[model samples]
Target: MSERTRIPPLSPFEEQAGFTRALRAGNRIVVSGNVGVEEDGSVSPDAGKQADRCFALIREYVEQLGGRMDDVVRVRMFVTDIADADAVTAAFSRALGHVRPTGTLVAIAALYHPSWKVEIEAEAIVGDE
Candidate 1:
């Protein structure tokens, strides 16, 4: 059996705090909750834009682990306001398109950032050769 490997994100927040952003075990990759913060740790303006940024960050981690967006099997979205669901879904659909993965959306009071409207976490599977 091959040993599990962890693919940590290179975020200053995580790096300074000594934590990994994601872990890869065998053919599965589990990503930590990702906020819509840019590489410089700035949150976007609104839910729709944040949703798009979240997916962009997720895609970065997914590709790092030898997988694509289509390889994602599950996703969890956290939103501060229920009213943003439609906008969030629209952004999500634009990113994932027909590759609909199992998803869950929850309304939360707030996120790590004051302006962050959405946060996402995901899991993907890479088939063994």
Candidate 2:
């Protein structure tokens, strides 16, 4: 049987809302959608900036669990504005350019927060260190 692990969300509200930031089983790790909102509850206005923050959060969680950005095998992006695609993807690419994980980008009608232009999710696999 494979082992399972859970990484708690950064905020108590997230815990109360019924979800964690990430979950892992064996070598596979799945991170929940991450927004640019910081610990102080501040969000960026630009999609690119938001993407940067999201990737940082995901990278942190992945590394904490014994994995690296290069280990990421898949990525998904939820973008509020189609025009912001370039900015969002640019940030995503910068974060995983060498790794180049399989990915998809979606233009959504809106997000939980109107100011949030983008949210990102990532999946990674740990292989022999």
Candidate 3:
């Protein structure tokens, strides 16, 4: 069996909800949906900034589970408004343009939090390069 590892979440709700921030099984890593909220519970009002934070957190978790951004093969982004798509795309480009992973962006009605404009998730394969 492939060894499995769980990367602890930065959010308290994750522990209470019985989910991890990320999981690694052998060479593959999957990061859960991440919001733009900070460690202190502060969130940016700007959609771009929030998306940026989500990507940052995703990168961090991927690395923690022994993967690089370049190994990320797929990403899914959920935005509360279609108008924010441009800003979120800009942020995604800034974060993963070099990796150029396959991605999907869809406008959703809302997130768990009212202030969250975007949520992101990632999947990566270690040493895929």
Among these predictions, the greatest lDDT belongs to: 3
lDDT by residue (9-111, candidate 1, tens digit) is: 4758787887777777888888888778777767767789889988998898888888888888898999999999998888878888678888889999998
* TM-score, cand. 2 vs. native: 0.92
Worst 10 residues of 2 by lDDT: 6-15
Error of 2 at 18 (Å): 2.7
- Least accurate 10 contiguous residues by lDDT in model 1: 2-11
Q: Which residue pairs collide, candidate 1? A: none
Q: Candidate 3 on 3-110: residue-level lDDT in tens?
A: 889976666877798988899998999998999998788999999999999999998998888788999999999999999999999999999999899999999999
Better candidate number, 1 or 2, judged by TM-score:
2
lDDT of 1 at 74: 90
Q: The CA-based lDDT of model 2 is what?
A: 0.91
Which candidate achieves the best TM-score against the true structure?
3
- Candidate 2 lDDT at 58 equals 95
| Full-model lDDT for every candidate | 0.84, 0.91, 0.92
lDDT of 2 by residue, 1-129 (tens): 788788756678877888878878899999999999877789888899999999999999998888899999999999999999999999988999889899999999999989999989999999945
Judged by whole-model lDDT over C-alpha atoms, candidate 3 comes out at 0.92
lDDT rank order: 3, 2, 1
Measured against the true structure, the TM-scores of the candidates, in listed sequence, are: 0.87, 0.92, 0.94
